[model samples]
Target: MIKIDAMMVCLDLSDIDEKLVAFSRTICERMQVGKVYFVHNIKLYELGDDFREMFGDVDLAQEVEGNINDIVDEQFANKTAYEVLVSEEPNTEVILADLVKRYNIKLTLLGKKMSTKSTGSLGTKLLRILPCSVLVFPETASFNIQKVLVPIDFSDTSVHALRLSKNLSDQLGLQLEIMHVYRLPSQFFPLISEEKAVRKAEEVVKGKFADLQKRHNEIAGIPYTLVRAANKSIAERISLHLEKGRHDLLVLGLKGNNPLPSLSLGSVPTEMYNTDINVPLWLVYSEEVIK
Candidate 1:
């Protein structure tokens, strides 16, 4: 029952990934969104003196809008209502943030190509500044919604994520899995043997998991698991879980324990973005649902 009225999709017209378009279309259909805004930002330098006159007196924005509409018609078959916007703003991030506010956008979709070196600073900034949720789709990601994995740490944000994931799973009839990864303190276990330390840590993790399950048993009526890794980073442990499990998507809660005044996402999600994991990611802000 999460109501998303409008969604903004950032597109790089010069390099359009078909997978990104397909995934966006699938989300639009599933969410039953009424309006989809396609936004593209261009540098001021790209506009030459003759460029405006070259298009038979058509403005630059109009020309770009026409092209975007054509692409949408051909690629997406015009499934949902859409608006095309082309901005000449030098800073794309600022323009995108402004559009999100102006349009009351509830979600933003960013496409990541496999060939790109990184998501770059723009992706990070958007995740931080945007008031709504953000979903990133890699070029190799599939549109299918099957099994979903959500990492939790018993925070309010984690509980909010679990609630949203449960709603989504119920709506889509998809399998949901909740996982918690714990790391044992190295210095505290120095007096005990490694085997005993590991056993104690497992017991502690199980106890915590059981407590969480009891608290949210109604929402998480599905299967859930707990993972314990002594030395591995949280991102590494999550990567290992994704490799072993058949999960197709990852739903994460942003601004969990480390709440930043400006940024919505925390260290764990930021690190996951930098990893080689190709699964599509859905990030839910704490304020979006926990309020």
Candidate 2:
């Protein structure tokens, strides 16, 4: 049986009124995770001590309370609980950490672009610290996993992402579209026709993956897709694969020797992550696997 989970989105004050509510709705339906909580940290620092003390002039508190209810009711009418919690804490990072423990949030979806690569971005810091699976979507990301692109190099970390896909496939009732993008002709012995190299690489990928595919055939929810594209750089092939598949989520393994670092949260992932493609991305850490 697949365990149910919560989908949390950090609401941005600047954009919440326009796209935030609709974005929450998209994930809840497409991913089929019922407990969708739109979290907003309400800080009392904004309100002066005089205002805080006077229940009569507590206008800031009233406005926040109203917005929370409006967002919950308007956006998540179908969810089991459309909860909005407030606290005096200034940091969303700290607040969400507490919520993860109290509510057992399985995954958190944040609308953070990859532009801010520094360690100081709240979302970036949260990604490092959060106990749950965190999805940092591009500013223009849409919530859907219609074609979940799993970039498998067959490492343990890759398998961890695949396992998360399996669990999410069960809950969302989605097709687990698996992709393996790799290369061959390792040095020396050069008979390098790009065409011939393509055929050779195809054979290598299939030869290695035939049994792994056969073993997971019981996973009916996931519709398997094996893509073998030839490119010198792994990142280039991944970007090209995304172009062809229209994949909604890029479920990547944490570690691989393939010239690029999946867990580094750097260029390749960050490139797609920073785009306006409007697709939700799930970054699964290797050790967090529920094996």
List model 1 lDDT by residue over 1-291, tens digit each: 666788988888755444555677888777768788888887857678887567555566676777777777767765688887888888888889889888988888887765465545677777777767888887667778799999988788877888889888888888999888877677865687878877887788778777877887765466777787657888888888987997899988887334663555777888787676778888887564423
**Tens-place lDDT digits, model 2, residues 207-287:** 656656576654434445555543445656766767787777777653323333234553444444434444666776553
| Full-model lDDT for every candidate | 0.77, 0.62
> Cα miss at 134, model 2 (Å)?
2.4
Per-model clash counts, in order, read 0, 3
Pairs with steric clashes in candidate 2: 141-278, 142-278, 176-222
Q: What TM-score does candidate 1 get on C-alpha atoms?
A: 0.88
lDDT of 1: 0.77
Per-residue error (Å), model 2, residue 227: 6.0
lDDT of 2: 0.62
Q: Provide TM-scores for the models.
A: 0.88, 0.70
Between which residue pairs do clashes occur in model 1? none
